[model samples]
Target: MSRTELLRLVFAQIFLHATMTGLRLAAPLLALSKGYSAGAVGALIALFALSQIFLAIPAGKYADHHGVRRPMGFAVLAAAVALVLATAFPTIPVLCLGAMLTGAAAGITVIVLQRHIGRAATSNAQRKQFFSWLAIAPAISNFIGPFGAGLIIDHAGQASGDLLAYRICFAVLAVLPLLTWLLVMRVRELPFEPYDPKAAPTHAWDLLKSANFRYILFVNWLQSASWDIHSFLVPILGYERGLSASTIGTILGAFALAAALIRMALPVIAARYSEKRVIAASCIITVGVFAIYPMVSHAAEMVVCAIVLGASLGCVQPMVMSLLTQVTPAHRQGEALGIRLMFINASSFLMPMVAGSFGALIGVGAVFWVVASIVAVGTPVVGKIQLRDNEMPPEKNL
Candidate 1:
């Protein structure tokens, strides 16, 4: 991908991502204001993945056929409508609708953008470089959307506490998709050979027949689960040990910052490290981090462990995205990516609940050890990933 095209795509990604994330932050706060319980809020948050889990495959297939612009156009519309609806109504039910729609829109946008870049990539290294650059979008938006929306929510009202603050936040988010439209709409799609109907596989699940696809998915799932464990357990761990909420948030923030920082270095290192080597090292390091988390007591020590965990898990996605394209056929690249996203979202959605149950039953520290043990056993499976080729971004100045 040219620098200009990559720049546009990255900016587009930030906007689309920021809209959903900002609304995600706003919606729960609004619901809480309207007398919703924590469980109700959890369900409201769960709606964000409703479409992502079920529609990921279809959305992927759609992108494969239509390319980026049309799919992204639909996403932008859905996100805009979701936010506008939430802004106007500001009810629990309406916010649920908003979460589902915006989540679906963001999910579809990711599928197409990754497909577009993967299809356009000329070499394995280029694919890695591109995905490394792309991977930071979520980390950046994770901060941007929530931070900006919180600022608006706190100060938009005449007073510090007002429902109108949330509505205004939603209104601001509603316009972000328009920005996404302006950035992505004009980018040229790659010239693809006509997809032949007869040659296509009978079902998306047929992809699992490839051992390579299955192994890549397994590794991807494990890393994704590791991420979930940290997000879910850390708060509990911090609470049990009497760490303050801000300290807990700071620790998680350290993880996010470390993940983003590591991706920045991935492009420079792409030429030196094979995806397999990077993935294996990431998994092993995650194992070590998991083992360390329960033993950490001081705030600074916990933050250090969190950053180490973040750096370890951050290396997996760019490598996984590159491998997903290599292990599947060209026509089905979108489908494969879709499957990967679907699987990861499904895992993300379910893993938290599982960790909660495990935390309640086994205690937080044991939960960490158990998950670490599982990852240790599974680390070898990453080495099982055989690929048709290597792929990442060009090692140019990125």
Candidate 2:
């Protein structure tokens, strides 16, 4: 893929990812508005990640066998049907179904896209650059999906939180995946590795047996948890400090903007540093931010913390992705990527509930202190992960 095509693919990812995020936001809001309890809302939200946890490996294997365009075609169909069904019905059951479908659809397409882009480059540094560029999509879309859906819900109808308003958000989200299809449907397919009759297939879990792959996966999960905790805890903390919803939104937005800006700069400079060094440094910075976060009473101080934490976590994804392609086999890269996604989605689903439980039992600040402490303890292993030279011939910019 040329730089132009790579960029178009990035936009394609943004549309698909945003559709899932928007629906995730819309579904929970609609459920809460209909007088559902907090526990019900949480259950509805958990459905968003349930399918991805179960299907990620299969989706990755499908991408490995079929390459980019085909898996994406199936995902696009699924997302469109899912979101369109939600728009037509806008009921709790429909939203539950939509949540699962859209989540799986987005996860499948993202795995394929990541597999394709990460392979497009010949060198480790070049893969780092490619992934750094690709990493910006989520940062951008995380903001776009929920913010756009919220805007539409607040202003698109005669009353806020009405059925018509949510339907409109669902309708708009349904169109996003179609736009993703338009961007990539005609793009050329990269060559996939042919199956060997004698060589047996490897399970995705087998990748975890490698010391380096385990280190990468663990470090990736560590940094990702920092990002998630910041997102999950900040609003609760801010609310306790008596900040309004808009103020909390602004604080989170500041973090997203900081993350995106840092990512935008990473592609040009990623070759200068080792992936482990970045991960280690990010962990340290994150620990510092989480330590001081509870003391931040003012919104401005919280925004500063948000930006610093975002900048730190923002650099981890591309570095981890760069490490992944180098650490894993060429043929099983998709499976490896799938395993990574599964771990991530699993954490994303389980962490909040655990944190909520712990938060209620102890306090929210203890949750941050606990995760930060674990990340700090694990930082030393970064130096121990070993790398080996790839035997595959240098790939062209596929």
What is the C-alpha local distance difference test score of each model? 0.87, 0.86
Tens digits of per-residue lDDT for model 2, 1-398: 68898898899999999999998888888888889999999888888889999999999888888888888998899899998898888889988998889889989977898899877887777788899999999888988999999999989766754888988889999999999999988677778976566868767777777777888888989987778777888899999899999999999989989999999999876878877778889989988998888877999999999999989999999998878888776667888889999999999987777778888988988888888798889888888877654434222211
State the lDDT of candidate 1 residue by residue for 323-393, as single tens digits: 88777777677788889989988998999999999888889999999999999999999878766565422
How many residue pairs clash in all the candidates, one count each?
13, 1
lDDT, candidate 1, at 74? 94
TM-score, cand. 2 vs. native: 0.92
lDDT of 2: 0.86
Off by over 4 Å in 1: 159-161, 193-201, 390-398
Worst lDDT window (10 residues) for model 1? 389-398
Point to the candidate with the largest lDDT. Answer: 1
Which ten-residue region of model 2 has the weakest summed lDDT?
A: 389-398
Work out the TM-score per prediction.
Answer: 0.95, 0.92
